[model samples]
Target: MNNHSRRRFLSDVGKGMLVAGIGSNLAMELGISNALANDDANALTFGSLEPLVDLMQQIPVEKLQPALVHEIQRGTELKTLVAAGALANARHFAGHDYVGFHTMMALMPAWRIAEELPQTEQPLPVLKVLYRNTARIQEAGGDERLHTAEPAKLADTRRGGERLLKDMYKGDMQSAERTFAALSQGERSNAYNDLQHLVQDAPDVHRVTLAWRAWDTLQLLGYEHAHTLLRQSVRYCVEREQERLKKDRPEPALRKLTPRLLDDYKLLSKKTGLRKTDDAWVEQLAQTFFAATREQAAEAAAEALAEGFAPEDIGEAMSLAANLLILHDPGRPEKWASPEKPKDSVHGASVGVHASDSANSWRNIARVTNQRNLVCSLLVGAWHTAGQTGYITDSPFAFDVDVITSKKLDADALLAELNTAVQAKNQSKAMAVVKSWEIAGNPAKPIFDCLRRYAVSEDGALHAEKYFRTVTEEFTTTRPEFRWRHLIGLARVSASEYGWPAPGRDQARDLLET
Candidate 1:
């Protein structure tokens, strides 16, 4: 391409005209049609994402790894590869399918893992997730049809998030998409904050995590494609609501409970308190949430907020309540551990994983949303977490660490012990080790290093990577008083998911090498 044509191509990309699903004819008109390299080049690809999206959709599962390896060797950006994966995922699943959206939830974390890894090993997470994405795409018959299209503009600009959520509640997909598309063009936070209102209306882990991940991948995909990325959340909400209506299931009690708690506590109009609490206070709050009914838990959180507790404190207590689910989980029943879903144990798709992921997502949502939504999200989280307590095991995991013989072990020794416990799948010992390390006032890095190894390599039934990311993030953002609880939560999960290797690590390593 000459300088003039290069300038034209870049200019078109700047104007967002290189959108793949809708711009093939436009590419031909611009005489840069070769960029759409594959014969089946139709999906919502954009700018640098075009050819990779084409390859991901059209390449056979057996052949895609080498093709991706070729793309990377030829100077393709990892962000672009991840961007294409997101677009491919959005095009194919659009947050509608179960496995489909789980794949979507893992995309950003895969990129994060790749970013932090050694250069030679960097491609493992990306390749593994892409392999999963394409395999699912092929299973759905290798179609190029998009579940999400270019959204139409809302005719009335006066409509906003509340109206958009109302549209979803009514199961109106077109109006929801249009409202969200127009909203996406405005301040990005406002659009995301609006979406949290709907996301917290249900206790579904996939809904909350998908909403957070869709907004998160924007760091790679950029806000120019915000409409494309965010519309998935809108569509997800609509589909879930539609499914609920189809089954004649009653609306989630949170729909009414959240607002009632918000108004009753005057939380919508008030700024949250900056009050901090001690460990005893946190333990008391967590136990209250653990044992209370959903309505009672929401009221407790609202009461705490009204009486001037910091939002993060309330979120911390809520996270602990969710962690309690993991701590008390009954091991997977033998009948449920079949070859088809072999990882159907307490570490993966259990109620604990669901609760933990949902609470982690709620914490993330709380950070970005408005004060009103923050309050509502916390209340809803408290309610949602309280609901999960019904699944707690008959015998809760022991909290007292009898195995730790020394009180002053250095960080490395503590980590080595913790790692031993994790490898052995000794949940009690792992929990005790981390708790002892925390009590010794050691730095967190060694513990992080210890857990990250398992998180990187373990299958975790697909939850390990995302859950690791979740705890790492939540630990950083949470208050110092309450953060170690997240690490303990991580140890519990890591120990539970210790033995199984990730699905394609060896294959990804070989493909990257040769």
Candidate 2:
């Protein structure tokens, strides 16, 4: 073989290789087109996809494409094409002359083919393709791009409307409110109309979004607007699933709606026409509301009590009732008084009498000792309620005679001793003393009298005043009382150089004046 013959053979081989490559490329292109065509032929089409196009137009440029992608992936196959076609229209209508409409148009058919194929056989390998792209579009602020109108015209008002709805769904209440406010009346109406359409088509989704919007609107627009939104939401829930109006729906929206509905009923009950003479209806509403949500009903009941009863009386009654309940319970803080010491029994006899006929001359003194201790206990217990500073035992005389005489102690010392005895669980002594004190007479009388004496005395007077003042301050801040002693103390201190004698004297005075 010569050089010319070898060259000719190599050239022939090169041509063969080029022809094979061209053939392969042509086949691949044709296959892609065929697959797209087949998918388009089988794909569902819903009217010019104009509505979706219109919606996409409202989204911002950066968000527009990604959101379209998201809707396409998540929506029905037909819906996806509509979304894609709409996106293409949005791009073209925005007038970027460099990119052919066909290039924008091509994605619909490709997505359609992807939709038609089994999900496992779909190209681009992962679900992230849809999700990642959608998120990117959102992050890029694609929703804002939708606000642009055509070259000469403002964008479709509905575009802004949908954005508002989306903002509401996102819990961006401030933006939603601002957008709604910025819209002209006509635009606002159109937005709501669009919302109505969306909601009518997908009631479940609408319910969730509407409930959220209602709550946000309530925060932004005050109770009136919030109430209106709440009513609409309640109606929607009731219309969609009447069972929701019943007690069983655990959907937070539905649950929340029930309370709102009850509130509406209560409001209605205040009307002159229906509620003025209709006791049964009012009762029924009250019962239903209470049965539905006891906590709300209780709050309402409390408000009613405030309106119907004197505030002071109602408050005192509630406190007293609650305290009584606790007092009755053995485990409560105020249960038993301190115990007494054990003592021998005592027989009836004069103190100076001799033991003449001796069987056993002396008898146990338990009864007498217990009686005396009981008086002391009662005095101490009652002392707790004296003029916001001292105890007020059930009986003043019993404390003076049984507790004071037997123990040879003053009121303040008795109070300290009582506290110690109670803390030590000396219940028998505590109860005995308490009983004896109650039998003595107004038990708190002594405590107040003792406070008065201390307040006036020179020696230990300042110490007494400080103690009383501290105790009174604590009481005023916590369990304040308005008794004659407190009033008297106030009067006495009013003219003195020293400021109010008690710790919270100013507060106590204010309370008394009120």
lDDT of 2: 0.29
RMSD of each: 6.0, 33.9
For model 2, give the 10-residue run with minimal summed lDDT.
352-361
Q: What tens-digit string does per-residue lDDT give for candidate 1 at 328-363?
A: 876567776754234324677877778878888888
Q: Tell me the lDDT of model 2 at 465.
A: 26
Candidate 2: misplaced stretches above 4 Å?
A: 1-307, 332-413, 427-514
For all candidates in order, the CA lDDT equals: 0.76, 0.29
TM-score of 1: 0.85
The backbone clash count of each candidate, in order, is 0, 51
Best by TM-score: 1
